[model samples]
Target: MKVLVTGAAGFIGFYVSKVLLNKGHDVVGLDNINGYYDVNLKYARLHELGINKEAASNYNNVCKSTYSSHFTFVKMNLEDRSELPKLFETETFDVVCNLAAQAGVRYSLENPETYVDSNMVGFLNILECCRNYGVKHLVYASSSSVYGLNKKIPFSTDDAVDHPISLYAATKKSNELMAYTYSHLFKFPTTGLRFFTVYGPWGRPDMAMFLFTDAILKNQSIKVFNHGNMERDFTYIDDIVEGVVRIIEKPTTERVQNNELYKLYNIGNNNSVKLLDFIKEIETNLKMEAKKDMLPMQPGDVERTWANVDALIKDYGYRPNTSIKEGVKRFIDWFKMYYT
Candidate 1:
């Protein structure tokens, strides 16, 4: 199947594209390569996929990957209404995995418009393109942050996600709603995966794993948020990619005669690890003690997040089994190799 993977240069998007290409699927990757984080890291990810940094920087130009005959990437924005439709019209993709968005919850607090432009407006364009073209399945990236302020032990799809603390979370929640509407009206399958704290090799620099590793190696103090009283379901990238690939391959089937095939699942490890314990894993991996700065909880931050991936397990046999220790070790190895 020919697939269009939005945010193909992103952390999860990069891995998902590589896996799909390895499976011999023709993949067209699209990303604006925004400077939300380090553009060099984004370029490095594209390089792994055989896209040259110079070629990938060109706006609206499609660059064929040297790594795989089945993979090609385009430098474009999801919110680009004009060019986005043209791509859709030309490719007529069977499946679209929309993972591109203005990521980072804390960043959203400062730059709210970026979240709206990329997450909300951009998602609407994706839905329109899917509807106009004959796209079969539309799988999108949602966030566990949508389950805001809920005291629920394990965040489930059945739980109410009406109270999103940050604009980023609100946008993610809105994406689920938008996808549902599109699926219901246009009769196409759409699945939203509320990813937990995904970490692994080539992880985002802003994330806890990357930040702690970088600071520890540089002998700088690492900011421990919530005064070392936080927990996260740290799902590994490979596990997250596996769940995505399964959903992309198998579009949800219609239960009723003509019901909308819309499904939502929490794609996570189903286990929450303490922030301090996670930091300890990093320290053990590096064999270096980090200068810890125990800071108060920042706004738009949650105390804990644990996903109940029972639905994912029941339907797709998805189980995120990578332990924090193993995952952090892999990341530290990559970090050392990449940095020095």
Candidate 2:
């Protein structure tokens, strides 16, 4: 199938695109390559996908990948009203995996407008294009952050996510609503995967795994939020990609809830690891102790997140079995190589 994967230069996006290409699917990747973290890292990811930095520097035009002829990438943003619609009309994609968004719980506190433009407005454009261009399946990236202050131990899709602490989570929840509207009205299948704390090789620099490794290697203090009281279902990147690929192939034909061809699942490791234990895994991998800075939990942060992926397991046989120790070791090895 021909697929258009937005945010293809992103951490998850990059890995997803590579997997799709390996499966012999024709993939057209799109990303604005914003300076949210490091543009160089984004470029490096694209480079690994066989997209030359020089060819991908331009917008609108598609750049073919040297690694796989089935893969191509476009330097474009979802908010580009004119260009985005034109691409949809031209490419006529069968499946669209919308992974692009301004991602960060804490950063949303600083730059709220970026969330509005990318997450909300940008998502609107995607829905419009999918509706108008006759796209079949629309799989989008939501977050576990939508669970917010819910007291639920293991978050299930049936649980109400009416309260979102941060602007970032609000926008992601809004995306689910918008996609549902499209799915109900246009009769197109849309699935929203609420991802957990995903970590692996080529992970985002802003993420905990990367930050902890970088700080430890640089001899800097790693901030232990909530005074070392936290838990996260840190899913491996490969598991996430596998779940996404399976979901993409199986679009919801039967209406599950609200009489819409829409479904939502928690794509995460069922086991929630403690924050300090996670940090200890990093230290163990590096063979060095970290200078710890035990601090109060920042706003828009949750104390714990545990995903009940039983729905995913029941339907798709999705099982995330990567342990924190093994995941951290893989991430640290990549970090050391990439940095030095």
Candidate 3:
């Protein structure tokens, strides 16, 4: 099947796209390659996929640049409605994995408009393309943060997500709602995956794992948010990609005509780990003690998050296997090699 993967330069996007390529699917990747973090990391991810900075310097989308035959990439912002539709029309995708968005909770507080433009406006454009192009399955990334300030131990899809503390979480929740509306109106099969704290090799710098690793390596104090009281379901990147593959291959069937095939699942380890414990794992792996600056929780930050991925397991047999200690070790090892 011909698959379209948005945010192909991103951590999850790169891993997922590689999986698709390995499976022998024709994939057209799209990403703006913004300087949200280090632009070099994005380019590095692209380079791993056979695209270089030279080919991805401007906004023009590059096609078939990789030595591998099955994958291609385009440099385009999803919010650019005009060009987005054109690309979708030309590609005529069978499956589209929409992972593109303005990520980071703290960043959302600083730049709320970006969340609106990319998460809301950009996602709307993707939905329009999926509907118009007759795409079979649209698997999107929804965040565990969408559970918001709910006082729940294990966040479930059945739980109400009305109180989003951060603009980022609100946008993710909004994506699920918009997808539901599109699925109802156009009868498109849309699956929204509520990703927990995904951490592993090639993870984003804005995320905790990378930040802590970098800080520890530099012998700087890592801010232990919520005074080290926070807990997160730090899932491995491989597990997240596995769930995505399972759903994309098996597009849900709408029970009746004129209705869309729509479902949502929480993809995570289903187990939460403390911030301090997570830090310890990183510190141990790197053989360096972390200078911890324990601090109160910032705005848009949650006390804890644990995903109840029972629905995922039931429907798609989603199994997340990487433990926090093991996952952190893998990341630290990669960080040492990549940086050195």
Residue-by-residue lDDT tens digits, candidate 2, 1-340:
9999999999999999998888888999999999989999999999999999988989776899899999989999899999999999988899999999999999999999999999999999999999999898899999999999999889999999999999999999999999998888888889999999999998898999989889998999999999999999999998899999998776555553346588899999998889999998999989999999999999999999999999999889877888887888888888889889
Would you list the C-alpha lDDT of every candidate in the order shown?
A: 0.93, 0.92, 0.88
Q: Best lDDT goes to which candidate?
A: 1
Show model 1 residue runs off by greater than 4 Å.
251-260
RMSD to truth, every model: 1.1, 1.5, 1.4
Q: Which candidate gets the maximum TM-score versus the true structure?
A: 1
Which residue pairs collide in model 2, if any? none
lDDT of 3 by residue, 67-129 (tens): 578888999988998899889888789989999999999999899998999999999999999
Off by over 4 Å in 2: 251-260
Q: Arrange candidates by TM-score, highest first: which order?
A: 1, 2, 3
Better of 1 and 3 by TM-score: 1
> Which segments of model 3 are wrong by more than 4 Å?
254-260
Q: Tens digit of lDDT per residue, candidate 1, span 1-340? A: 9999999999999999999999989999999999989999999999999999999999999898999989999999889999999999998899999999999999999999999999999999999999999888899999999999999789999999999999999999999999998888888888999999999999999999999899998999999988999999999999999999998887455532457488899999999899999998999999999999989999999999999999999988778899998898899999999999
